[model samples]
Target: MNSKKVRILVAKPGLDGHDRGARVVARALRDAGFEVIYTGLHQTPEQIAETALQEDVDAVGLSILSGAHMTLVPRVKKLLRDNGMGDVLMVVGGIIPEDDGRELINNGHADQVFTPGEPLDNITDYIGSKIRS
Candidate 1:
């Protein structure tokens, strides 16, 4: 096992029932040697933040495809910060537009945003780089 195992919480937030992408990302992260905890589906920001706190994860990765990224990401970030877990890196992936992605990052909601079809290695490398630093 890798000496530096980054604990990550991969969550599917909102009514987005399409979880194939989220599941694939979780598997890729696991294969990359990070310990991944996946929150099944239909999770709210509160639930995700609470899970991140309880799991002591180094990062929280949310997969949002319902065009609710704007509302959801900031809420998640705020909740985490309020719960004293502000250091936990937050990331979002899925059908997010470039403008919205930038907004989320600028608002300090997410560290990065991965759109659909981005390689798995990209996600793994990003997580590794963030956690290892």
Candidate 2:
């Protein structure tokens, strides 16, 4: 086993019932050697944050496809900030509009945004780079 594990929390927030993307990402991350904790479907920002804290993850990756990225990302960011875990890197993926991606980064809600069909290597590389630095 790798001695250094980059812990990541993959969460599905809001009413998005589609989880195939999230699950695939989780598996990819795991295969890439990161310890992944997936918080199934229909999770709230609060629940995601709490799980991140409990899991002591280095980053939180939220998969949102319900067009609720604006509302959900900020909520998760606020929750992490309130809990003094704001330093935990937040990355989002899935059906996020280009403008919304910029908004998320500007608002400090996400460090990176991966759209549909982005390679798994890119996601894993992003996580590795963030965690390593």
Candidate 2 colliding pairs = none
Q: What is the C-alpha lDDT of each candidate?
A: 0.92, 0.92
Candidate 2 clash figure, as a count = 0
Q: Could you tell me the C-alpha RMSD of candidate 1 in Å? A: 1.7
Please state every model's RMSD to the true fold in angstroms.
1.7, 1.8
Q: Taking the tens digit of each residue's C-alpha lDDT, what string does model 1 give over 71-126?
A: 98899999999999998888899999999999899988899999987999999999
Give the clash total for candidate 1.
0
Instruction: Give residue 102's error in model 2 in angstroms.
Output: 0.6
What local lDDT does model 2 show for residue 76? Answer: 95
Residue-pair clashes per candidate, as listed?
A: 0, 0
**Which residue pairs clash within candidate 1?**
none
Q: Which ranges in model 2 have alpha carbons more than 4 Å from their true place?
A: 1-4
